[model samples]
Target: MTDELRTTMERVGERFNLGEYEIDAYLAVLEHGELTASEIAAETDIPQPRVYDTVRSLSDRGLVELRESRPMKIVAVDPGDAFGDIRSSLAEMVDELEARYTAPARDTEAVSLVKSRSTILRYLEEIVADAEYELALSLTPDLLRRFRDSLEERVAAGVSVELLVTPASRAPSPEEFDYESVATEARARRGITTPVIAVADGEYSIYATQDALRDDRDRYGVIFNRSALGFLVSGFYGTVLWTTAETLATDGESRPFPRTYASIRRAVKDVHELSGEFHVEVRGRDVATGNEIHLEGPVLAHEFDASEQVASFSVAGEDGDPVSVGGLVAALEDVEAQEIVLDRS
Candidate 1:
């Protein structure tokens, strides 16, 4: 190989350092367009064991196509055509990611009402695990007891967990929930649960209601996710959470919680544009320490990006200016940081 060719090879490797193996394979195909693994090995002087690996990687990255012609050839894609495919693939990926993270429900009208217990449980698990922080739930004594182990795992992950148990559920003092049990379970797992709604981490809220939820395989569970209906369920049954063993533990007389209707007139304006989006609302850390801070929000209206290092962010604001998401994340991490000062362009 000539000096210029060597330099280009090095540059190709450098450019694709992040993507690694695939890009190297693509470069190999570019230099020797029609070659089998053995041909690639011989031309590139790569080890025999790695020849197949490189050829497969190149094919996987869509840089080279394998064919069954005269010599079992591998053809390199045209530069312009190859790049167009990559760009299109990335665009589709971003769309799918945004849908899962930003928009929870879509394209379900014709999928048949998924009312099966197994399906409901699976959906509930997906929604629950995706929660960024905090999970507010209301369940009877029977239900909580069943999910006790799972809740303990969530609480231990530095997540705030607040649960209210009605006094009437147990006549004889309800088995004091084991703190040791809580701690031990937490030690064995990685999870997080928030204390309550104090500037909640994630916007979407998940709730489940069942007379008796058990580990039994035969039983079915009903779990549904909805911002509009959840707002109502949570608002109306606020007492189920407020009347804890602590509140009624000291109340002059136990009383049933009154229905909540404070937010009855609230309207849920559809944020349709938010479909399939991931938003990182970067702020600053404490000014004194100059640490980094980052907050991720499920958003459709925001276009945001930040580098790995807490340097700066690029987000289009109401006015259309380039702002730094990483910079903002750092600013918010600072103790003195204030309202999300977005970079508006």
Candidate 2:
């Protein structure tokens, strides 16, 4: 046989092998068009005793046809004809398996340890997609790119996204990153030693050691789902990590209103930075009747917890009436705020 023909046969053998013996027996019949069990054993290295068993296996898989002649001849079914049914069967089986498959119930589990880098990445993507109101993430440059699409989707859906990337030099530039497309704000930390961290809606969080990205085989991460442990992760993120990071880009116009008193304090600080009068609107349900309430006016005064989870502020309404409001941070989940418009009039 020509080297080209041998190479082609070798490729085909590897691509569609049933087993070593089955491939040897099938290829022997293909070479001769048809071969009796003894002829196959003579042409291929398969033992005489094993050739018949190997041929029988190929026949069972519909890869070869068997004729019940005196020696039980094996016929090479055309590769096209042989694999077409196998391909169809595989496709149908995949569809059926997909239909029956249910995603694991991981959301309710308090804690999970994920060891595969790919699985950790998948969970990160899922956490971002599942967020409704808030997201906080610290990522390496590589992960930032991997999750860019998922982040953009959630931001477009009105989920607030705060992103921090480490080793500022490795991060994409603001122009290249297009921060407005994916995040409410993006910041950069000074060093590469930071762990990869993410919190979704301030409830679900993932914390991974830096090695998680260095070696896929050595990777590990922990997921906290609505567990009190999540609070520790978020606190470290907010107080230690986020506070020390330098801003890279921000979409002030698209920033969602502060939903918690803690977020309110952050908003107030931003207003304070402006050193000017600003119009503010606060929307929430009245604790008594659960009736929706809207308070809009120029900022008067504000008070909040050091943790920013509880707050009260006074606002002057359009009617020249002073209104005072106070509530837990959890109460602000239903609230929405427009960009603070400066009332220079």
Candidate 3:
């Protein structure tokens, strides 16, 4: 063989080998079906003295079977069967490693600059998935499509999602896309100049230039980790973008059954949006009894304060008496519909 060809073969062998001579010996047996140690060393470039050790190593790794014949032959295991246990071991290792691993603490800096499009998209997806209570996003039509699954998952998990897509003409029309499955409310901004923005639970936020989506190489985004900094992004979204945007779609019937509300106003608003009389299940601690209460009744009236974060709602039981209950929104854990009978009988 040419010197160049020998070097190339050695490089190829190195990749598949557990150690020197192992891959060469395994390949020799695989091609020849069964080979004695001396035959393996002769078929490949392995040294005669190391052939037994190489084949023994292959045997121990289950890549080849060893037979104690007069010449002690090495037999190659089928590639699929040989690697099945290794594949399973690798998968198990990954699971155990992930379970035992602890992620490093994030840097406490309030603001960070990210310059890669892939990285920016990754953080955007993470922000959406991490949201607990609410999410607000301003996305290019492309980004809206890219994050459709992530947004749908969060909404299905009971996080309130409000989405804006720009420029209005480029966005999918309500008939073309199922926005109600992903976002509680969706709108289309009139201009292309609207920057991509996202705020999660009013705590984490990201703002990026349109170029971030238009040019992968020229991508950039700003991340705000602190709530104080996040508010600036949220403020810009609420005051400038949200007010001027035209509603594309709204899903009043798709609202999540309220659970662990942070804002009483939002909770009350959700309850009010329900179509007709619905049975309510309120789960909380009874202040007087110091015991857990699971109350079910028809809601009579509901009131809430956005500023004070307090809510009072009444429910009527079978005896036709209304019981008034009031609490801080944070303390009200869950209010779910027990039944939604179409008929008012």
Candidate 4:
């Protein structure tokens, strides 16, 4: 808060001062190019008594021109001319404020609440760009476009991305969009009820409503950055939202082997679809003792519940004994796998 910066900020605030009534009255006059005080009250909800004062305030700020004739007409000044001086001042003020801004502690906070649409969007982009292996996202068509480049970067880095775009009809067709470059698989859901979500490596995630992406003041988004806690988001996405979505695109190219995963469900699904013998190396915690364990051997068997709520796989250990591995916060299985690597040689 240097003196120069604080002075500039106060000057900008004073020059652009606008209240609810002033805004409504200004818009009414702008829409019609000019309006009498009575006409402004008719066009907007601004009370008849307040229209004169509101317009007078606008005139004081050089946003509107007032005629002294009968009825006192208010004319809209060209916005470009009206805001010319303050526009530069506002930009300077923003630069000064941003210099003083502190970034949110994403790595330290287990969970955080955010309200701005821009902040939510920024976190979504960071999540997609930061994924090292697995990614899951539910986005609108507009958001899909906004983060397309980041998704493509992750896909090229061999990250597995499962994308869900809502309002099926509005999603781009395969001909119009290159799905192969952005996702391992993509699905479309039929309605706007889907919340905007992004999970990175099954750990970092954000959950927000569609309303949170709009100009509305009442909406919010939540971020979850703790390890293992991400399964809450991924589980909900897989069991509830992903199951109901219609597949739109899937990468047809053969994926290179030696794949890695932080999710047991995805690992089980991939391993089950393979034909020949495949080996798995798992790093997880023993369900019984909660002690960390590392196991590696050929896959023996796997199970998936119809509802996708439960998924696990068995692998032979060094002692040639079968050990069952499950996902985060596992209950029934022998091991709660934090990471699984699948390789076929």
Predictions in order: lDDT: 0.39, 0.71, 0.72, 0.87
Which stretches of model 2 miss by more than 4 angstroms?
A: 1-90, 253-345
Error of 4 at 329 (Å): 2.2
lDDT for each residue of candidate 1 in 204-225, tens digit (9 for 90 to 100): 3333334113333333333333
For model 4, the local distance difference test gives 0.87
Query: Each model's number of backbone clashes?
Result: 39, 1, 0, 0
lDDT of 2 by residue, 242-302 (tens): 8788889987454544433223434554454445566666665555566667777777766
Ranking by lDDT: 4, 3, 2, 1
Using TM-score, give the best candidate's number.
4
Residues 1-345, candidate 4: write the lDDT tens digits.
Answer: 889888887877876678999989888888999999999888999988888888989999899999999978899999999988788878887987898899866788788889998899989989998999889999999999999998889988999999999878899998899888899989999987789899888889999999889767558999998876777888889889988889889872367888889888888887666677788999989998999899988889899765566689899877788888888888888899998998884
List where candidate 1 sits over 4 angstroms from the true fold. Answer: 1-114, 171-175, 179-229, 239-345
Model 4 lDDT-worst window of ten? 250-259
lDDT per residue for candidate 3 within 75-140, as digits (tens), equals 889989887755665555556657768874444678999888877787788889889868889999
- Model 3 misplacement above 4 A: 1-104, 216-218, 257-345
Q: Give me the displacement of residue 34 in model 2, in angstroms.
A: 24
- Between candidates 3 and 4, which one is better according to TM-score? 4
**How much is 168 displaced in model 1, in angstroms?**
3.8
